[model samples]
Structure formats: structure tokens, C-alpha cells
Target: MTKNNAQKKAARLHQAANRGTPFPSAMRAVDTRLPAAVPGTPWFRERKRRLVCYCCGHPNLIASFGDEREDTARFELYCENSGCDAREIAVIALSGNMIGTSSRADVRTLTHFPQSATSHRTVNGRYDDWLAGSEPWVRTQRGEDFPCLWCGEMDSRLSQNDVATDRSRFHLRCLNTSCVVREYAVLIVRDGTLGTADRPDVMAIQYIDTPPSSRRTPGDASYDFVAMQRVLDEDDKLARRRSTGPIDWSAATRIR
Candidate 1:
């Protein structure tokens, strides 16, 4: 987008930002990439405001957005809870170049992007640095911000033996004794946002699983009838010879 057109988009979005302006110091937050930096004006930080559906608080996929070009972004937030399928549109303008700073180094760098995702959290990189950067890590070297999904325990601590290589992995363990949490990796929940003990807007880890005794649909011929018959036959054989103990109905619990 041209600098002039970018400026117009910023202006319109600026109005929305002004309405919900956060009470922080104003700072320009985009790389204009212009030939020369503008001087003598104080930089106005880009304002961020999210529009989610009132019916449902969370949206399904942010993977879709409109005009996601450089300067301004217009996007639709979709919520799919209980087949509601509600949507809320959102707009935000990015400011390029600090108003008064002649050099880029003089202004605070603002990174505008979401965190990357991975199929497995066990991969190695500076992600350890990011995951370990939570408030709990600084205060007590724990992973309270991104708790272990298995144990639901947040006493996360880094491995003591990591050599600190770029691709070297950062391992975390849950402190719970009865739980099965161990050395595992982390997942980025939010990029460019620091999570604290009070607010955990950072990385996390979760495990997905299914029980082996999951129920199948009734009258479904796709099931293994031979295996079911074999089990029934085995039970018949056991019933013929079993006299070791009497039935104890009180010890058994009903599924329903």
C-alpha cells in the first residue's frame, strides 16, 4: 500500500482506537519503510481493540481476515459455539514511523504478528526463551503461566542441563507426584504479549487422547463381530468352570 493510502486507513482506524484508547504512552508502531523519517512530531502508538461476538466470548479461527495488507487490517471474528455461528467485524490501523524520531533506534520496536504453531511442542528453538519468559519464570523459575496440561499443575521448571544451543530443546516438568507430567515442550498462546501471574496471555501445552473402551454406535456392522463372538465364547467356557467366588453386586458400580 502507498504511504498516502496507508495514512488514510490509519486515520479511520485511529478514530476507533480513540474511542477505546488504552491508557498507555503513545508510540508509533509500524515500519513505514519510507525513504526518510518524518521529524518534529510525537509518535502516536497504534491502538489495539478486539471485536468478539457478545453471544459467545471466544472465536473459532482467526486464520481469516480482510485486506491484511501492510498498514491497516479489517477482519471478521466468527464464533461457532452451539452452532450459533455469530460474527463480529473488527478494524485496526498501524502507525508507521515514530513522529519525532529521526532514527529507528530512537523509537521502541513494536512487533505485530501472531505466534507460530507446531504439530508437536517438543521441537527445539528459542521458543524455550519465550516460554520461559513468563512472570513465574522470572520470579521463581516456574511455568505457572503455561501450566502442564496433563497434571493441570503450573509448577513448571526448566531443565538444569540444557546447553543453550539455538536448536537445543528447553524441557519443562510438572511438580505433581500423582500426575504423569514430565519433560515436555511448550506452545505459544499469544505472540508479542507478555503473560504474568495475574494474566496468562502467553504459551501453553495440552494433550489430546481417546479412551480405549470408547462406545460405538449400536447396530453398526462395521464392528468386529468375530472378536465379539470370541469374547462371548470365552465367557461361556469360564461360566462352565467358574465357582471360585460368589457374585458381589455391591462392589460393582453401574455405568449409568
Candidate 2:
């Protein structure tokens, strides 16, 4: 499908998730946070391009803390620009793809009244379980036989089948969210770097599956030799550029 078509379908899926919900709370529980990338992931060792911040144009904004969930590592990227209080969370599979909203560009506001606790919307879950239960809601792959993923029960409301990604390819969902998997973030990674808006180096990359890749041709096997060499040549380049130091941009006044 064309980019425009994909976007429209994604919006519908989001709507369906909310409209046909048997469990709104569960949906919230599932789709909230962004996971991080770590050593165990497939791409971590491969050395793709550095993950730059799409929001404020900051490069390598990720901070990784060894959380308990080995399968699902959590990565938090906060834009500490004086007035730009945008932040994002991401979840990375052991295999190395950024699943769900971690792949999204539009950000959630880091909650704090000029200076307070930034309300994080990120939710964490066991990686394997999440991966196994929630298969990609692809029409070509799994959409033919399965009913609507959102409701799990086909109501008259979910008569049509149109899927889309958001304005950016950050997330994809049913034109209407039924109840479950339709409204979800598409796994967006390209050339080893996590893809985001306006970043051509990684944009338009094929969606790489977190688990075993099904496509025989060009699975998650591609990498940028130039970028990889940079990783080896300047081992501390990324580390020095993206320090996980405590971020306290609270003092930076917000401009209306």
C-alpha cells in the first residue's frame, strides 16, 4: 500500500481499539511504554547507525538501565531542549527491532509543571509473552483468516478492512481499533538504526520483524559499513555523545 493509504488504515485501527474494546484498561496496559536497546539484541553487536532524536534533532538520545525484563529492554529518550519538553519511550526485542511506539515520532509530553515529576506513560511487560501473543496485524500475512484483532468478536461496526500507519511510519493500526492488536506500533528499523521522521538515512527501510524474519531476501541482515566502521573506530563516540546522566531540564522555562 502507498504511504497515504497505510496512514489512513492505521488511524482506523486506533479508533477500533478504543471503540470495540472489551478492555480499555488492558489496551492501555499493553501499548504504553517504549523499550530500550542493549547488548543482547541482534543489532547491538551489528553496529547500525546511531539512534538520533527526531524531535529535537539530538543524536543518540537513548538511556539504557538494566531493568529486570531481559527480553524487553526499555529505552527512554527525553528531549531536554529549554522549552522542548518532549520525551519518548521504546521497547526493543532481544533480536533488535524497536517494536510499537518506540518506533513512533510524535512524542508524549514529559509531565512536569516547569519542575516536577514527568508523568511517564511507559508500561513494561515480559518480552517473550508480549511478542508471542501479539503477532503483527498484517493483512497480507495474517489478516486473511483472522477476525478483527481489536474486538476479537466481529461486530457490525468492523465491516471494512483498511489498515494504516500514522502520519509518520511510527505506528500502524486498524482504521478502527476493535479491541486488541489492530491499533499497534509498527516495528520501524532501517539500516540498523531505528527509523524516525525526516531521517533519510533510515527512512523507508523495510519493517524488520523482532523475532525470526520470514522473508528469505534481505531480512534484518543489512547494515551500513560506514556506520559500523565508525562504531569500531571511535568506540566511545556514542558513549560520550549520549551520556545517561540524570536529565533535569525542569528549570528551562516553557515558552507558550
Candidate 3:
């Protein structure tokens, strides 16, 4: 090809390469304040609002937090397009006690909070049992399928699921990971209180050493239990820092 043609082809290839690259993921900012509507009162209304999808930017869906209670609100937003199962969903449970709202009008104020960008680690399926049964802080029941509090992924139907106390919850798998063998803790914050044992809320991460005898992958043969332990241990430390307000080194380190 001629020099001019070669240059044009190179330019086209560069443009195509850039187009193929995926965009970075982002999280929405969470507001921890309750709305003005009382749970039992007639004035209390669960409103669903629509916004342009951050991924496709198509103004085709409505999303909002389910409702506001005494000092907490469970908010969920997802794509409305039936054809688009992009899984671009966010579920946020905010605490309102720390930040006071003057009235219901104030509660309407919304912000785009960012989620943690860190890539998730993998764990074993055996640990999944411990998470669902033993961990009280990270469990949520949905019909027969139990979803994890941290990532909201469901547990295996074959495995028996368990429940925890009102304060904490957990799930067997990390939806963000590929192996489907990771566990996550779901910590609920009450009234925006931080660091205090009474008000402290957190989600812990843990992994198992050996793969289940039922199934194993080529990658599983090389799994390192020690590394997994360190990761969980570090995650626990980071969870403590995140629950506290200071935003210390531990919190800053584990987060991507």
C-alpha cells in the first residue's frame, strides 16, 4: 500500500482499538437520611423515579429507593429496558440518623454516589456454607433463593441456606468474582452512628482453603489458602476502618 494509505489504516486501527476498550465502572453516592413520611402514616409514599442509565445513557427507565423508615432507607435502581440485561443495578441501604433532615423535602435530595472499584477475589464453595449458616450479619432471604447482603447474589439451591441475627448478614458467593465460591458479609448501619459497638455495621470477606471434592477446576489445583487467609484477615481490618468515621489507613489500603 501507498504511504498515505498505510497512515490512514493505522489511524483506523487505533480508533477501533479505543472503541473496543471497556469503560471504567463507577458507584453512586449514598445519602444516609430518612424521608419525612412515617412508615404507618398515609402520607408515607414509596416513590419510583427514573433517570438516564449511566452506562447506555438511554432515558428508558425509572429507579429509586423503595421507602424511608424511622432512620433508614433501602434504595434500588436498575435499567428499565427489557432488552438490556446489562446488570447495571445498585442497591443502597442508607442510615439517616447521623445526618438530620429538616423535613420530607430534604429527603428528596439525591446524589450520585460511587461504589468500590476494587476487583473481587475468589474463595471456596465449602466456605459458602459457613457464610450462609454461621454468619448472622450477612444473610437475606428471597423466597427459596437467599441473596448475599453485600453483593445481592443468590445462593445455590442445592445448598441449604442459613440466617443470621438482625444486626448482620452474609452470602456464599461474590457476584463480582468468576469462581462463584467467595463469601461476603453485609453490615447494616443504624442512624448513621459510626465506630461504636452499638452502632457499628460492616461486611466481612472470607475464603476457604480447599476446593470441594465434588468439583474442581484446573485453576483450583493451584489455589493458595494462605493468600486467601491473608486477604480475609486484611478485609476484616478494612471493614473495621470503614465502619469507623476516621477513614484510616486500613480502609484506604484494601479499597481499590
List candidate 2 stretches off by more than 4 Å. Answer: 1-39, 42-50, 64-69, 80-83, 92-169, 172-256
Candidate 1 lDDT tens digits, 43-152: 11122222222222333323233212221111223333332222222211112222322111101111111222222222224423222232212224333333333333
Model 1 residue runs over 4 Å out of place are: 1-146, 187-256
lDDT of 2 at 11: 47
Query: Poorest 10 consecutive residues of model 2 by lDDT?
Result: 203-212
Compared with the true structure, what per-residue lDDT tens digits does model 2 show for residues 1-256? 5654544455456657767432222222344342343334322223332443332234543433321122222232333333222333332211112333223221111111111111222222443111111221232233333222123233212113222322122232333332323333222222111222223211211111111122223333554234544333223222221223332222122110
> CA lDDT of each candidate?
0.27, 0.27, 0.27
Which lDDT value does model 2 have at 74?
A: 27
Q: What would the per-residue lDDT of candidate 3 be over residues 1-256, giving only the tens digit for each residue? A: 5754544455455546666321110000111232444323111123334544322335543443322222222223445554332222322322222222212211211111112211222221442211111222122233344433223344321112223232222223333343222332222221112211221122111011111222233445543344554443223221221232332223212211
Error of 3 at 43 (Å): 13
